[model samples]
Target: MVLRTARVGLRLTRGQRNRCFGLLRAAGDVWACILEINSWRRRRGEPPVAGYQQLCRLLTESGPGTFAELDTAGARSVLRRYSDAWFCAAARRKAGHTDVRFPRRRRALMPIRWYHGTFALDGRRLRLPTAAGCPPLWVRLDRLAPYPCETIRSVTLLFDAGRLWIDITAELPVATYPAGQQPDPDRIAGVDLGIIHPYAVSTLDGAGLLVSGRAIRAEHRMHLADTKNRRKAVAGRAPKPGQRGSRRWRKTRRRARLVEARHRRRIRQAQHEAATSVIDWAVKQRVGTLSVGDPRGVLGLPAGRRHNLRLRQWQIGRSLAILHDKAALAGIRVHLVDERGTSSTCPNCRTRITKPAGRTMRCRTCLFAGHRDLAAAFTIATRTPGGVITTPAGMPAGVVTHRRAGRHLPGAGRSRRDPRRPAAPGSVGRLRPAPPPSVGSRSSIPPGMDEDPQHTTGKPGER
Candidate 1:
């Protein structure tokens, strides 16, 4: 199915607002009840239960959280809607033999509800069904509510920053042009994932591109400082459970959550921008496929006193996942190459090099040198076109190949090589830290990596 999503702003009436709130309350109640049942199981030394259907039946029969505005029918329906994810981690814990810890419940926001249907769209307001007995409550369609589209599968209502909004996700149909037109293999781009330069870019043309998100580190530092300050202030007189609802505690909690949410929003937006930019360039260059470095291995490194502060700011794997999805849509291919020794191995001589200085990688064996990240990207981009990065589950057939070369941080050498590292055939050695290139050095592009005129290939796997 081809799904597309569009956000349509709403103009809601007061009654509609109340109804929306009622719907949210109902959803929250369902989640709370699920959590409560799991908590009961925990206390009884029994395994927690998964699924919200049973709970939905119970809630429907019990007639809970159904106010005048949030009528019984709307409440039950809303409860049933978001039930798939109700148990989540609790269910995992139950299956894994882990003890379940009950979550605290918050007071319900009253009089809100949501309706899904062939909601009649009349200008800004959407008309949806309500309880049979009561007159329908019309909500003021505002920034929070948007007219639902046929393309969307579901809409999630979120209350944040003292306001309510709906997050709509639509499944978009993949764009198809012609078969046999795979991206050009010659103009490949090597991308180095990093904290400072979130994207270290080097195309087959030897041009360098740096997409940086340095402000993220600073924001994280501020958050850390604020967290510490709050921690120290509460150290001497940590409040009990009931006392947590104190004004000061509530204020601090809200502030902390706001800061965290802001950080996440910024990081997510940055990743989207970076991924879009890279994908656009690849499509334009008609690069046949991409060999991206997998840097998530850096996450397991100890968060000790010597930790790299830069590591905490970015999620390289997440960015790559977004890139991969977009590349598929653009009909560009990506390969995950083994990142082992990618930064350390000389691109020219294939000799392992020890990184000796800041942001610089030098080949001790052949004296070949380059910035560390670009070298890894180049190495990945230069791999034989057919190579695939093997994962624990053997490579699935029919997807485009993207090399998976991972970076080795400055302090990572003392530990033994991780067995789970990507298994690429070329250069098997220790990875070394490489310095970031000076702002404007001419980056060397890998051979056979360039954008050529489109050569039609087979159609992408059907949805």
Candidate 2:
């Protein structure tokens, strides 16, 4: 079984919220205590108490009720977090990364986790483990847990964007298909990741799928504009460093957090939608292996500010992670291949060509032209490690299937307008009606004025 985790918001009363934060604060205190103990050891030229067993012993020696409302299992999870981080940093440093640092900084709040037996999940309600003498803390979830109770392994309570959330981790079995329709191990597809098209997949059978990300890009642009406007509006009210903020400023900060969270949720939802589309397509095609192009190498280069912002919004790592997780659940294999020359090299002639300015790539050597991303996918499909490319006959055909991600986005529909936005400049709602008829209108003017006296008195050119 594979492990998966889903984060869901918590619905809590004012008292419950405060209690939850108190538990988190207790976890933070535990973390600080460990750090302080280790610091003392360092000062005395002795080995630090970084081992989990030693830390548990230290905790036991401190006795009960030291951390209010925090149970042993919950506190141990904090120690586990620290131990894991410490080892991870040590391993990285050993591997020639000098910048990796062990966990030393203290936090005001730390997430507390409880194993399955320590907590109770009843439909939408969860009973968190507290200290022995404390009253039972039962909190409601904003929505029912996605996984079944039997599959749930642990729950972690944390705060994000000024709101409480719980990450529910569960073990899930890999998807099983019917006997005749199981994924074929030999069938492989190539995935080309990009900014405009998050996923461009091409199978060995000449079929291709393109998941457009225009809506996602639009969401990013609109969110950036909204954030800029908000910051400009609140700049004057923002407190200086070391100064306490007024209630109004705090409210603005909260609003900003909500907006940022909303934007993140929207983007994450769209990315999942895109990855789901790819997986569904793969399953339908009976494709088992996906060769994904890794473009992270180019990220370290000195790109301009605008390009950097674009790359940051692209969120290549998150895209890959979602794709990998979904693929694993579907019993599909994912391989990350270097994508250095995939976009520039022509698939037909194996000749290096300039990267296309638009989405269409043309090969002057062979006079072959097609969608740039699709071409990259086709090329990436043949690429294997050790600088070898295996090309099957009749590969990289012209047939392609197009799909769009984030169709649920506000501006993704045919209207091309977000419902939350005001009418555009030339739209019907914003257009002004023509001016009323002038004062010389026939109905409002006198009869003589309407007849034009000078013309009438001319007597038909008699002079």
Candidate 3:
């Protein structure tokens, strides 16, 4: 079995919202107290306490009601968060990363978590454990849980993008297929990751699949332009370095944050759709293994400011995670291979060629021409780990299946970004239907206009 998480929003009344925020602040206080203890230890030249058991003992000694409306389980989760962070930082520093620092910053709010047995789920309602002698805190979910209640392992309550959400994690079993329909381990496919096309899959049989991300790209571009305009419009109202922001400025910042969150949600949904398409195609073709190109190694290199922004918005790491997680659930093996020269190398002759600036790549040595991304996928299959020379004579893109992502995003219509492309079905801001022409010819005038039977300026039988 593997673990998965889905975030579901909460449906709360005004009082519930305040209570939830209070719990978060309590968690933050718990975190701050831990940090304060470590600070005193540092000042006295003594070792800081970070062990989970020791911290729990310390919390018990402080007595109950210390964190109002926060139970032992909830407060312990915060302690666990701190201890984990400290260990993670220590490990990093021990591994030659001296820049890594232990947890020291104070936060106004922190997420609270409840284990499987600590929380109760009833359809769309959730009962969260609170401090002793306090009424049980029950909250409603905006939507039903995606996973079976029995399989749910934990729930984390956190505020993000100006909204409250609960992350529900569950353990699920891998998919199983009928006999003869199960994917063959020998049948492998290669995946090429790119910004324009999020996923390009090529099999050894010359079949391919390309999931276009043009809509996602346009969404990012439009959002960027919109954000720039908004920022410029409010530049005069922005607070100085030492001055506190006015009420209007605070509202503007909140609006910006909401917009940013919405943009993130749209992009995330589109990426998931793209990944799902890849997995569905692989399953249809009985593909057992996928060799995905790892491009993160090159992300740290300076590629100019414009390209850097483009790369950052590309969100390559999230794409990889989405694909990997879905592939795991589908019982498909994935290998991440170094993708340094795959895009420029000739698939037919195995010779290095200059990377083309366009979608098509031409190899001078072999006179080969094909979709650049597909060629890279084919070459990536040849370099899959745990296998030697698995790729056959590389073929140009053929019998390819095409799909698109981000159809539900705002401004997905043809006019918002590209005039040539039609709007995606079910997209936001779809154009209105064309209206009847106002101007009419003499032979086809409206009935109310110049309607004379004997000397008619319009056609006869106007009805």
Candidate 4:
């Protein structure tokens, strides 16, 4: 069984919201107290209490009711979070990562987690465990939990993007298929990850699938433009460092957070759709193994600001992770191999060629031309670890399938345009045209400049 977590928003009354935040604040206080104790211990030249049991002992010494409305189990979860983080940092540092730092910073609010049986889940309403003598805290979820209640392992209450959310984690069993319809382990497909085409999958049986990401790219660009415009509009209202923000500034910040959250949700949904498409295609083809090209090594390079922004928006790691998780659930194995030179090398003759500027990749040696990303996938398929690279019969002729990732995104459908964009120059519902150039006046001149061209009845070739 694999563990998966889904976040659901909370619908709460004013009192419930306050109480939830109170619990989170109490958890944060617990975290801060631990950090302070560790700091004092370090100052005294003593080993810090980073273990979960030791921290629990310390918490017990502090006595009960120390954190209002926070039960012992809930507080211990915070200690567990800190201990896990501290040990993770130590491990990373020991592995030659000097930049890794222990958790010492304080937070005003921290997410509190409760394991199964500690919290009560009843359809849309959750009963969170509170301190003894405290009234039971029940909050409603905006939507029903995705997983069954019996499979739920834990729930974590946290605040994000100006709203409260609970992440429900559940253990799910791997999917099983009927006999004679199971995925063939020998049948493999290569996946090429790209910016424009997020997933390009090529199988040994001469089939390819391309999932376009143009809508996602457009969403990113539009969000950046909107954010820049909003920031410019509110630059004067922005509070100076160490100064409290005005009410208007706070409202603007809240609006910004909402927009950011929406953008993130849209992108995440589209990525999942893209990954699902790839998995479905693989299942139909009876392909069990997916050879994914890993491109994370180049992300650390100092690209220009524009290129860096593009790379960041690409979200390559998340895309890969989503695909990997979905593939695993589908009983398909995913192997990430080094993708260097995959796009440039010709799959047929193995000759290195310059990366194409567009989607088409043409080989100078073998005169073979195909989609660039698919070509990369084909090459990647051949390089799967511990797998033979034998070409299937009639390999050059593959059935190509085209699919789009963000069809639900604004402006993605045929009948809908992005509401965020202004109307086109000649589109309907736009304001009426200006007076039809005023009967041969200078207003009819084309857009290059304001100057009116010299009018004459000259024929062709006349200056």
Of candidates 3 and 2, the better by lDDT: 3
lDDT of 1: 0.53
Worst 10 residues of 2 by lDDT: 454-463
Name the TM-score of candidate 1. 0.63
Q: What TM-score does candidate 3 reach?
A: 0.88
Model 3's alpha-carbon lDDT is 0.83
After superposition, which runs of candidate 2 have C-alpha atoms over 4 Å from their true positions? 240-242, 385-387, 394-398, 415-463
Task: List pairs with backbone clashes in candidate 4.
Answer: none
lDDT of 4 at 50: 95
Worst 10 residues of 3 by lDDT: 454-463
Tell me the spans in candidate 1 whose CA falls farther than 4 Å from its real position. 1-18, 35-123, 127-129, 134-150, 176-190, 202-208, 222-260, 306-309, 333-337, 382-463
Whichever of 1 and 3 has more lDDT, that candidate is 3
Model 1 Cα lDDT, one tens digit per residue, 294-348: 7777688877753565565566668787878887777677776556667676666
TM-score per model over all chains: 0.63, 0.88, 0.88, 0.89
**Candidate 1 weakest lDDT stretch, 10 residues:** 454-463
